[model samples]
Target: MTDTTDPRHAHREEGFPAQQQDQPGLTDETRPDPDHGESTYRGHGRLQGRRALITGGDSGIGRAVAIAYAREGADVAIVHLPEEQKDADDTLALVRAEGRTALSLAGDVRDEDFATRVVTETRSALGGLDILVLNAAYQHDIDGFESLSTERMRRVFDTNLIGMLFTARAAFPHLEPGASMIVTASVQAYQPSPGLIDYAMTKAAQVAFVKALAEEAGPRGVRVNAVAPGPIWTPLIPATGWDAERLATFGEDTPLGRAGQPSELAGAYVYLASDDASYTSGAVLPVTGGKHL
Candidate 1:
């Protein structure tokens, strides 16, 4: 007898069904009301007067955070890859629509020199930086370790980890008391998957980096934190080659039974970058639907 199951389909059987969860009304399309006075949220002025620079701010969780920060009264500088200029422009539009200043910069985070330039330009354009969000990442899956090429593995580490370090180093001097640094980690950091070994390893490094850097920067009143998001519905999914069925079933295996949306995790970033989390440092906040909890 011959087997007919697709290699991709084989993985689907290991996961559960997707569940539907009701989400809050805010979205990319909703216009922010300036005079609403934080009535829309339980917290007010969490990041007031703060100036933030967010890498990968063109889309996904980055875009969501940019909008949320503006609503909370912060100016934003969004850094994006060259190929994502349109998304960057859209994000800037949303920030301006929120009645806050927005700067859109295009470059790759993998280059240390470019990372430094981004920091300089952002400060000149935004006046200064109080919060830094290192949210950019890249990954490509391989079936087995033997099949993974050195080039692919290097690219994964360069984007997910090395670039993050460069961004942080470049922004360190500009960050002062009450400022915060937030990095986007993933659930795979704690719960590894064979197919995404390289990506998972880099995420694990990010968790470690956050803790170590927090201690080093604590004396200066700068806080460092990370957000470990589980499967979320982002463009990276379809762009990375997931089929309709696989994409539809994304995040189903977790206890929540559904993938989270980008908007769902934005508040956590806002809180970490705000004064409300003053005593919170060297911590990793898992937005993973109770996974590994």
Candidate 2:
């Protein structure tokens, strides 16, 4: 690859220390700092008066979306695991800094009851649910088929797929006409990474679910869509069981020869969640820095 990256933000090495965190990572401790639009995002009221709930909004792409949505004038609620309180607090602060209503709700999507409670509380607190960003995911890599334990596989499916199903079902009742449901699928869905079979399967299933939901929800004036991103610099990358070498050169194989920043993806999310995309549904918007779907 020629590395034809822009200079000011050229494809230089992302300055993150080669290290890993627990299953769901934290943003504050990351080196080189994954940009979550903290300093530079400029919004123009695309989502004015909207109310939204985002899962995994404690950090990374979810945090970026929350920040962008708040800047665009939406009341936002974010869901995170109890252990991720610090990241959730940071996300809440960032949203509040935009002078918008912000709430941080902590719960595990793996529990159906918890998902329902989160949705109900979000609607009550935020007034109503105009947008749903289902982005929380679990990915623990295995060497191959043999190393994959059955217990691990089931856990992945529960957290990554069944949880989404539960949350979406709970949120559907609160979603009114002209609402939007944007999911976070991934390039791994179409690309199918061998080591990440469980994660990839859930991602591919999400794309299909979105297309089906778009059809089912269209008559109700609700739009369903997804974003499939290539390698992006985020806390999750470090926690995904990659070795130090792979972690050091993450996203280098992409045509852009660099990993994407979480902030870089905020625009696609904002557009999909905004009225500007009222006619856009059942689409997978790929922000892969030149990678094809």
Candidate 3:
């Protein structure tokens, strides 16, 4: 799988199927299924006694991280929308199956005030927060600037950028030097798609925030970083409103020849959260199937 040239092609023969759904797409409906490492991920107790809070943990990269964290011996609290309860339940079951504590909190990240509340509730539920994963985001494709609406732009900025700021700030009081904050950035931040201008802006802003926050939070031993993914197949894709053709051939242009699976991404977060990454701060790790950052 590390060959970086479609080593996962056996799984890619099916490709990431072309599909569409309303915002916050459901995982059960996604074709070929997304691999969250359920039967494959083996734990090594890397995160024993750690407590974490991950946004959008009901599915996609967030869900994969949640499963990996729990298997690594960390208790987890996942924040998701009320409408995503079904998916949340599935994730919760997997965590508890690992003998790790799990909490599913429902709320909208764009609520502004909800960010602090989400952190507060997670800390209280898990006893403390050493790992904060700001993995939730909002994105949509547009034909061009003309199709981009002020409302859509505002929603994107509010959810993708403002929410990260609010959640990270709220978790500071609960974090110590060994704590890690991992934001879910995108390669799109560095290589912008004309159709994704607004979404890309927020992602680039996230990279800047990570660098600055790492410096400021260093004295306290709290590291800030981000994972920039390329075309990983997740519910977010179809939910982003991509057309049929774009959806069908997604990630084929990458050197890998196909999109990445969610399972392929869990290790980066695990490393960042574990003591293994003690000195790794303010770095943006790209997991784009060999795509350049």
Candidate 4:
């Protein structure tokens, strides 16, 4: 467990520490702080009596949102890939510590059947559903587009775009009026990345889907929105192809001169899922360190 009270772990003006070359080993503490402001973010129970399902809630921004949602009085169901069980467990513990019921489900979002099963289980376990967060994503770094194989591109699209659609569709039936759907897009959606062509394309598609879905569901009172984040230090940084040097310089080029923390993105999700954003839908909130997009 991380010491959330540590100033070094808090959302410092200097941001989270960059990866250290001298330290080859990385622990939870060394990883960027995912849960920030837990001791201080006072929730007025905006999501009181509501239930939420968050994909990829195992870590990164998803974990942050889970904690915040719990604080805001909403029970949470977290879905993660099988390999992310440890991170998922950590998030579940945080939710439970917040005095909210938490459900941890492990499955690949690429499978539509699995997505449907997760929704069914979450609704059954949580008793109802009022918010759905599409946050699971997959990426692989290829130095060039020509080097990207068709199979890899398919996998990226399946997990990043298709999976999100399936999850939303599965949850749609159970979502009532006033329910909200939030998708995790990426800054790559607006700013194309040559090396990450497939991943960026899928993210762009996600934004379009959010807009269209919001329009279609508007009459039904379900709002759909997206959060496009910039560089954020997470396990994905190491899991993906980013080298140590790149990780060390993460977000230094952004106007903020630092990458964002998962905690910084949590409030956006809470606001979108809560009644505070009642009139807001089909909107894209960019937490990209002031990237011009």
The prediction achieving the highest TM-score against the true structure is 3
Give TM per candidate: 0.85, 0.95, 0.96, 0.89
- Could you give me the TM-score of model 3 versus the true structure? 0.96
lDDT tens string, model 3, 89-130?
A: 999999999999999999898887888898888888889899
Each candidate: how many clashes? 0, 0, 1, 0
Q: Tens-digit lDDT track for model 2 on 168-264?
A: 9998876889899999999989998888998899999999999999999999999999999898888888888888787777887787777889988
Model 3: which residue pairs collide? 177-221
What 10-residue stretch in candidate 2 is worst by lDDT? Answer: 7-16
Candidate 2 Cα errors over 4 Å, as ranges: 1-16
Per-prediction CA RMSD (Å): 9.9, 2.8, 2.0, 4.9
Once all C-alphas are superposed, what RMSD does model 1 give against the true structure?
A: 9.9
State the displacement of the C-alpha of residue 103, model 3, in Å, after optimal TM-score superposition: 0.6
lDDT of 4 by residue, 136-245 (tens): 88777787767998997888898888888888988887778999999999999999788788999999999999999999899999999999999876666555666667
Residues 1-293 of candidate 1: C-alpha lDDT, one tens digit per residue = 79684322322223322322211112232212111112333336677788999998877788888888988889999988876777788788878977889998888888999877888988898889999999998766576789988997898899889888998998998898998999999998999888789989999999999999999999999999999998866555544434446656677777767666677688899989988899999999998866972
Please report how far candidate 2 places residue 80 from its true position, in Å. Answer: 0.1
Local distance difference test scores for all models: 0.78, 0.88, 0.90, 0.82
lDDT of 2: 0.88
**After superposition, candidate 3 runs with Cα above 4 Å error:** 1-10
**Ranking of predictions according to TM-score:** 3, 2, 4, 1
